[model samples]
Structure formats: structure tokens, C-alpha cells
Target: MNIEWSALGSVIIWGILIGAGLPALFALGVKTLAVPAGPDGERHPSLGRRVGAWTCFGVIILAIVGAVAFIASGGH
Candidate 1:
């Protein structure tokens, strides 16, 4: 049987991105949120770091939801 190389390649790329990339993104989000407070005495981090962490988490959540929806609808 002949293999469709293009389809295989596409699957490989998407798999890597979704599998490794998503987890790595999640780790980065955790790391971003874990940074120490300001030198003097700030308990919370700056708004930008908080936003970045949330944005990364949001993207991952969206990706998960999208995958579920796609599967539910019989994804292509």
C-alpha cells in the first residue's frame, strides 16, 4: 500500500505542535506566573506578567475546547 506522505507530514507537524507545544506553553505560563515579587515589597506581579500568563493559559484552553468541538463535529 502506498503512503500519502503529505498527509503523514501534516499529521506529524500538528501532533508535535499540539502535544509538545501545548504542554511547553503551559509550562511557560506557570513559569511566568511564578516569578518573584518586586524587589521592595510588592506581593503581586506586574499587570503585564499576569496578562501574559493568562493569555498563554487562555490559548491552551481555547485549543482544548476547539479540539473537543472538532471531534464532536467529526473533525476533518
Candidate 2:
């Protein structure tokens, strides 16, 4: 049996990236929302942080949707 080392390596790289990167991205979003924005340490985060966090979450949602679509297409 012949093993395609390059293809296997690519699969491994993508797997690790998607598996770890998404969660880390989520954590970053959470941190952005949770951290204080002003010197007075206000309860609500700033507008920029809110926008950034939402953008991160949106990207995650898009990734999930894309993956489901790909799988439904039988990995065309």
C-alpha cells in the first residue's frame, strides 16, 4: 500500500487548524466583550469591542454553515 505523504500532511494541518483555531477565536471574542473598555472600568464594553466580537462570532457561524453545506454536498 502506498501512502500519499503530502495529502496526509495537508489533512492533518487543516484538521488541527480548524479544531484549535475556532475555539481560540471564540475565546478572543469573549475576552473582548468581558474586558473593560474605559479607565473607570465600565460595565459595558466599547462599541468597537462589540463589533469585533460579533464579527468573530459571525465568521465562526459562517464556517459552520460552509462545512455543513460541503458535507451535504457529499464533499463534492
Candidate 3:
């Protein structure tokens, strides 16, 4: 049996990076968005936080779409 060591290593590394990194980023975004309530019981996330969260989500969505497209195009 023959194994492509480099290809196998690349896939493992990429899978861990993307699989873990994306969720971690998304979690960070969610954490930023979760603002604590003030004295008046109003919880407001800053505009920057909201934007960051959306950006994270957008990146995740784009990645998923790209993966789908790659599959559709019969990429390895």
C-alpha cells in the first residue's frame, strides 16, 4: 500500500485549522455581542462588536459556499 504522506499531513493540518478556527472565531464574535445588562437593565452591544460578529458569520458562510462550489466543480 502507498500513502501520500504530504497530502495526508496537509489535509489533517487544514482540517484542524479550519474546523476549529472558524468555530472559535464565531464564538468570539458571540461573546463580544453578549453585553451585560446595565443598571437600567438595558443590554446593548457596541456597533463594533455587532460588525465583528457579522463579519465572522459572513466569513463562515462564504467558506461554506466556496466548499459547495468546489465540490460542484469536481475539484479533487
Candidate 4:
């Protein structure tokens, strides 16, 4: 019946940062990598490819951080 507000806040913040923030960043990366024709509607680089690369990078970083945190937390 007891709740730890600090732990709850940490979880919420990490969830938001990983869940929404990573996707948003990936979107930004994709947008930046996209090539647009001058008023001709031509496109290159492919949004999907860019998004994948961004997501992979984000996931790697998250995994490393998570691993370090887990080790530091004594796996508790």
C-alpha cells in the first residue's frame, strides 16, 4: 500500500524520454536526411531508411545506458 514518489517519477520520466523522445528524434533525423526536389515533389534517401538508422542508434545508446544502470543498481 506504500508508493515511492521518487521512484515513480524516475520511471515516468525515463519512459517518456525513451518512448516518445526517441521516436521524435528519429523523425527529425529522417526529415533532415530526406531530399526534396525544388517544387517538383521528387524525394530521395527514403524516410524509412533514415528512420531505421536513427532508431538503431537510439536503441544502441539506450541499451548501453540500461546495462550500465542495471549493473550499478546491483540488479535489484
Q: Name the top TM-score candidate.
A: 3
Q: Which portions of model 2 miss their true places by more than 4 Å? A: 36-43
Cα error, residue 38 of model 1, in Å, equals 9.3
> lDDT per prediction?
0.89, 0.90, 0.90, 0.75
Q: RMSD to the native, candidate 4?
A: 6.3
**Which residue pairs collide in model 2, if any?**
none
Runs with alpha carbons beyond 4 Å of true place in candidate 4:
37-76
Tens digit per residue, CA lDDT, model 3, 1-76: 9999999999999989998999998898788888998899987888898899899889999999999999999994
**For every model shown, what is its TM-score relative to the native structure?**
0.79, 0.81, 0.83, 0.49
Lowest summed lDDT across 10 adjacent residues in model 2 is found at 35-44
Q: What's the CA error at residue 60 for candidate 3, in Å?
A: 0.7
Candidate 2 structure lDDT: 0.90
- Writing each residue's lDDT as its tens digit, candidate 1 over 4-60 gives 999999989999989899999999988887867677766476799889989999999
- Candidate 1 vs candidate 4: the TM-score winner is 1
lDDT (Cα, tens digit) per residue for candidate 4, span 14-45: 98987777777666766666676647676556
The weakest ten consecutive residues by lDDT in model 3 span: 25-34
Q: Write the per-residue lDDT of candidate 2 for residues 21-53, one digit (tens) a residue.
A: 999999989988997557776758889999999
